[model samples]
Target: MTGRPAPAVLPPSLRGWLGLVAAFAASVVAGLGIRYAGEGEPGRVDARIGAAVDGVGPPWRSVALAMDSLGEPVGAVPLVVAAVAGCLLLRRPRAAVFVVAGVGTAVGTATLLKHLVGRTIHGGNLSYPSGHTAFLTALALTVAMLAARRRGRGGLGLGGTAAALLVLAVALVAGAAMGWAQVALGAHYPTDVLGGWCTALAVIPATAWLVDRIADRLVDRMADAGRRGRR
Candidate 1:
């Protein structure tokens, strides 16, 4: 029998890579719109969406609070640790590294964008790209990418297309959920959440690809060195 295929790592095919590039481009375009259209205040779009979502009670508020916590250090740390531990159990060291690197890069990008864009919501708070949304979306994207790797044929039997779609779908859903939570609680404008979502989308795929490239090269070098030593 043929040996099991290697882990998917990042996008496994040319089409997958193209799709990620398109996604990154789309995110950059959206971010540019937000940055130039209204740098420090809510635009018309943000006001309308925020007005619709801003106030709620009971179960939704409770749910939003819980979801919000997932992006915080208190909840985010444990979840990340669990993901890394699970990757080790599955013998996927590169994926474990990706889990850490991907999330860190996404969050850092959001923080940097917040400073650069200088969008504000509540009295001088830098809010253009919600860091909470970025964190949760990054976490979700990392998990989805790992799941794709485990499937062996680029996710659920559909090759690289399936893997790409799976990663994007998971990231989108997670970002939307967190975005809604942030809006509902009046923590951010809708555009701010949108910026955060796009930031993760723009950053994670690139981060995954970079991690794979660097890690693979290092592994190859190590293997060559070992062979030379044995010789």
Candidate 2:
């Protein structure tokens, strides 16, 4: 036996799978409401959250600015490269692909949604579904899913529950951090950040499942072809 580890399967368990499906649906609905309510301006929720950040001083403002930069192209490219490289270093080619594809798709979807929703802030800037928030959340989700799968506890048991919780925790942390930064910087409305977070939640699990399914099918076909040639 090679004794090497198998590639990680996403969702990690039946409950995890169901949870993802529910999250996706809820996120989609929430995003739609945010879009409709805020199109062309901030919504009721955004208004309550306020348009300005007060009492933020040097380090906190600096930190917020830094966090905001992480969503930009210059910042995001390096992060994506590092994640892909790390996955390849661990000999997880599928995970490498998942990181690239998932992050890109999530960010791209947010961009498309911004245009479609036409939600604007601070003028005509399309801002529903904060792209920066989506980018970080997507990256976090990809990493969490990989970590949970690598734990090799993707069964319908306590381990699976822990894995699911880990993914949720990571996603929330990433989403909240970025969302806070965007709102503080007045770069987006609070509802916009929420929309962005939901966008990632809705997109990532499905992307992971698709990547796994396609990669597995390709590997199986290649293995079959090799056997037929040998015979």
Candidate 3:
């Protein structure tokens, strides 16, 4: 008897899903902890950190200010749009969808959480989560995801893995730099930045999974149509 063909190993999506779930859980837990720590009072940590960060000299101030702008609409929107366009141009419709959904969800969630939690730091306007940090982080992550996906099928082996890691590291550094700017400018507390980062982490993978599911359906449909045509 002829041996059956070996089953093809599917690419791993479970790890991404699991990571998204864990991040969502962590974001919830951290938000609650921050709320509890404030306890209807202004956050002392916010005040202390704000003061320390503000004390730095002009050179650092210039850098912080530049990083802070990255989270603003003027800076962030273009980058996001360009990344999405690039993915579409490359025929990665799924990755493009993930970029829009992931970034949009992260920003929307941050806004919603701010309202729901109704907490503030030093009495300075809905400060539970930093919107600027959320936007910048989401943008950074989207770029990294697109880069990794683009290179994934190129058979670069270990080099591909290293390149992906490097992209992720750079994205993270950019996010952290923006977070520091927010903190230094006294625009948000450290916990607020943490919340934003966690939210992005949660949303990106969830969106990626959704997009992947849609893409799989499309591929299956096309394959079936091709088979029918051949008949």
Candidate 4:
């Protein structure tokens, strides 16, 4: 009997995925650019425009800013706790590495675009895409993906259901908090944050699927190798 390794197929092209990604990206650029550009100069989502009409002033604005600032740290706490627990239970040393890479690449893309766009920059406003929001979203989504994948393999269906719910809730809340912080802090226009989210998710879906597929293949390969070695 002849023995040979199976061919590896990294997804996307096999599923007409690349075309969809390109279309989505083009749409994001057009939609976000138009909405953000229409807003006129950028600064703290123009809280003053509506507030002045309402006759609101001072500490209220300050309070809003403070709340925005408060959200990031608060949201981050859940992720940190989950990550620590993951370390103890799953020992996935590469989790943080992949997360950092995804976030760093996303943030860097935002920062570069912010400068390259040549829009006015003050108080974090030269925004095509909001970096802070994107960073947190990337982290949140990545963790959620990891949690879901692990849950799928666990034998306890009830526990897995609970785990999946918890992961989804945390990721959604954290991601929303991050977006809220950017909007409240006047760090970016709502359009900028939305666009950044689109960009991040667009990159993420394909990458995440590929990573998961590759991981499964690698695990199978390693197990096969171990069995061969034993024989």
Candidate 5:
């Protein structure tokens, strides 16, 4: 019988996972700082920031509304579905699963934490983590990760790396804009948004790792099947 093809190692290296862990740790620390701050300093800061945003000219109001809409369930859910469909069309079922699971977990975790923490500020209920921010950030990061993997396979050439970086930069910008828009609309505190982002930072890489493991197993099985057929 022909020998099986060796199992593949997932592309995102150990150091990459470490970086995500560090980011998650930092976000947890930041969330705790906001949570325990006497009289809610984070809430106060959020209010000031929101006021500043409100004062940033009339046209910006429209822009903020537009950005905020991107995070709304009506818009975000459909976009995520479309993205998953696109990934499936590209024959990356694992990537598509990652997108759905990452976003779902991020949003669900934020909701659970909000309820568990029971934080309220400025007459808002269960406002610790911004669900909208978490959803958008997770979606953006998933898209970037899928795009990078799709294009980064050939080689880590300068061109591929540059393209990946460009995609990441844009995704980050869009996520940040959406988060800030949440603050501008008085829907969530800045710390809430930060918590959402941190949650996504923790969830996305971990999800990717899980999906990669499953994909690796499937790939190994396929390779083994082909080897047997050849024999």
Candidate 6:
């Protein structure tokens, strides 16, 4: 047929997007698992949940609270990536600006959810939609979107299979590690991370597509303006 590679299939579709939303809702339910399950006697889930709900303890407690501080690393990360993307743009390089924008979207969404959803921190804030969880999930999403964009580029042989596996691995690891860290530090009820991941998974794929359309239009407009200015 034509020489052009088959148009890359969008990795996620409408049904898939809805499924992701359902999954996030499921995560919210699952976050309560530690509350019911995780049998470590009566005080197990409660103790940890209480800790997170109450916020950090005294000075000593704060120092040891790496999980709570996971946001620090997450926040620091997008900055560097955004800067790199900016550099690429400066050089007229085809860098991924969507990835940076995606992080911003996650952050903005987290802020809105934190206030609007009225979910508490642990008790007062609810902590159902964790910022820590959102941050990690968003990072994984960036990797997955970038990988999907790269598909069918060189060839779809063994190399392609290996590459796909690698991309999935990266996304899973990043998402999972960040999620677990929050759980470990007792900063979020397990459900919070689950909801966070589910929400992110649902949103990122559509965003990737939307960013492409918007960027293309901006590029076209820029070219048109350049032509008129040269007249």
Q: Which residue runs does candidate 4 get wrong by more than 4 Å? A: 1-26, 34-89, 121-125, 152-172, 209-231
User: What lDDT score is found at residue 122 in candidate 2?
Assistant: 69
lDDT of 4 by residue, 104-163 (tens): 565667677666554443544476776666666666656654554433322122244454
Per model, state how many residue pairs clash. Answer: 0, 0, 0, 1, 0, 8
**Which 10 residues in a row give candidate 1 its minimum summed lDDT?**
1-10
TM-score of 5: 0.76
Output the better candidate (1/4) by lDDT. Answer: 1
Between prediction 2 and prediction 6, which has the larger TM-score? 2
The digit string of per-residue lDDT tens for model 5 on 1-231 reads 233232122254333543555376457936654564333335567767767764445687788888777777778879999988987776666667888888888888878777766667665466767788878877887776555543343323233455446445755676588777877766777777777777776776677667677776777788788888889
Candidate 6 local lDDT, 71-103, one digit each (tens): 676655755476446435444222255556666
- Residues 51-134 of candidate 2: C-alpha lDDT, one tens digit per residue: 456236788889999998899988999999998888877777878899998999899988988877777876688887789999
lDDT of each: 0.78, 0.77, 0.65, 0.53, 0.66, 0.53
**Which residue pairs overlap in candidate 1's backbone?**
none
Clashes of 1: 0
Q: Give the per-residue Cα lDDT of candidate 2 at 87.
A: 81
TM for every model, in the order presented, reads 0.88, 0.87, 0.76, 0.57, 0.76, 0.59
Model 3: lDDT to the true structure: 0.65
- Candidate with maximal TM-score: 1
Error of 1 at 93 (Å): 0.7
Q: What residue pairs are clashing in model 3? A: none
